[model samples]
Target: MDESDGEALAAREWRLIREERWPGPMNMALDEIAAETAAAGGPRTLRVYRWEPSTLSLGYRQDPDTVDWGYCAAEGITVTRRQTGGGGIYHDSHGDISYTIAAPADELPGDLVESYRRLCTPILDAFDRLDVPAAFAETGRPALHDPACYLRELHPAHDVVVPGDDGPRKVSGNAQHRRTDAVVQHGSLTYAVRPERHLAAFADPSVDAATFRERVTGIEDHADVTRTAAVSTVEEALAEWADAAEGSWTEDELARARERANEKYGSDAWTRRRPGDR
Candidate 1:
């Protein structure tokens, strides 16, 4: 190997892949690739991406028929399923930024719920930076009965909420997928968009947007700042958190990610893979 190769190997490195803003499927596909890469031996990565033209993304387990296709299409929204399980989310450009964290499972807790709290702390710190009074929804029943991720009350390490006279308002929605090798946890940081759009996408006919908003709060709604400022706040907070944490993936690892992305994530079979596909 060349002398420079040794230097590159010795230096701690992390790959940052920021492709042009893509649609929902592309973003999810790339994140799956990154996770597989980590699983194989690639350095842990943080992929920040946006859905262009906006779209409504459903959790992997959710049935497509559950979404209001006509309503989404009329609003120029594209629909796709995420690798993670959760309710439908109407992603609007300029309203939110999404993050996917790919890392080895060894670095996180064994229990899925515990892992969520640990990962979400930085998000709480970001809210603290904004001076927003936020806390994780307490763990238990209320958390489970709420079908929509954003609608659920804070759990030990779930979403963030701003306490109010009436109750808590959700400001973020996050979820995780734990693989044998790595974990990919992602969530949306709400910005300028209306929760009504997401509420409308739900198949449930009885839900009311006003009532939901009255209970839920986006980052923009909870903070005493501008939307742009909140976005920057989260960016910086996550960066700091990652920096203090030490770890790096090897080149061979990235190659594995490519293989996984192409074979699993990139394939229609995997993208459309359902509950019993295994």
Candidate 2:
């Protein structure tokens, strides 16, 4: 077969894991496992998932002080740190739709921006499918609040925004963690805005719900789609883009992910550590 035919066949063999709901640590652990599996010659995987009981995912280097521990505990929000760097995100069970794409590093472009564009194409397509008119932010905007992901400064590569009467408002945030042999890009697509809960996740976030409403947006804000429809749209978009077949986790993979969650993602030592300490 020709090189083009070979590439097309490879794309069609990609794996799609339908949305599953899990706690924060397990969700993060599964992402790591997916990357490792892909690097070991497993199928390239695209997984959609939700966090049950909600969660607050802190950036790799985000300050612990920025989080409102008391508030999170009171509200039953699980706090965990992600391998990717960015600000903290409040992953509301009803408000956020999250996804992860994992593949061998060599399969993606070496250039960071190019790789982001390649991986984020399906996300943009998903927004289009929902009639949300979302696209990568054209320029970086000065942060309205530093510790919150949605309120942080926007980057043209991974931050997706939708047009508003006032200006563009952010709708999604994507970030990557590249290992020697694999890459995992995960993003949160806001399905519905929960500005109060988002801001409350941070300690003394100098901004209010009104300011958040002005700067951030969700799929439901611009489109008439319901949360279920939004989730399905994103899944269909990713599957079609990768030409993927539905798949599920193997028993061994799930076991390893559980162990990793307990030892790393679920541990306070890992979550509270400084940036380079790990």
Give the candidate number with the greatest lDDT. 2
Q: Model 2, stretches more than 4 Å misplaced?
A: 1-12
**In candidate 2, which residue pairs get closer than 3 Å at backbone N, Cα or C atoms, i.e. clash?**
none
RMSD of 1: 6.7
How does each model score on lDDT? 0.66, 0.91
Error of 1 at 3 (Å): 34
152-223 per-residue lDDT for model 1 (tens digits) = 555556666677777767667788988888899988877655767877766664567676676566666656
Q: For this target, which candidate reaches the highest TM-score against the unseen true structure?
A: 2
After aligning candidate 2 to the native by TM-score, how far in Å is the CA of 140 from where it should be? Answer: 2.6
The TM-score between candidate 2 and the true structure equals 0.96
Compared with the true structure, model 1 gives a TM-score of 0.78
Q: lDDT of model 1 at residue 178?
A: 87
lDDT of 2 by residue, 1-278 (tens): 23563466356358999999999999999999999999999888999999997999999998888989999999999999999999999999999999999998987889999989888988998998888889999977789988898988889988999866677899999999999999999999999889999999899999989999999888888888888888899999988787789999999999999999999999999887876776
Runs in model 1 lying further than 4 Å from the true structure: 1-20, 139-147, 152-154, 244-278
True-structure RMSD for candidate 2: 2.3
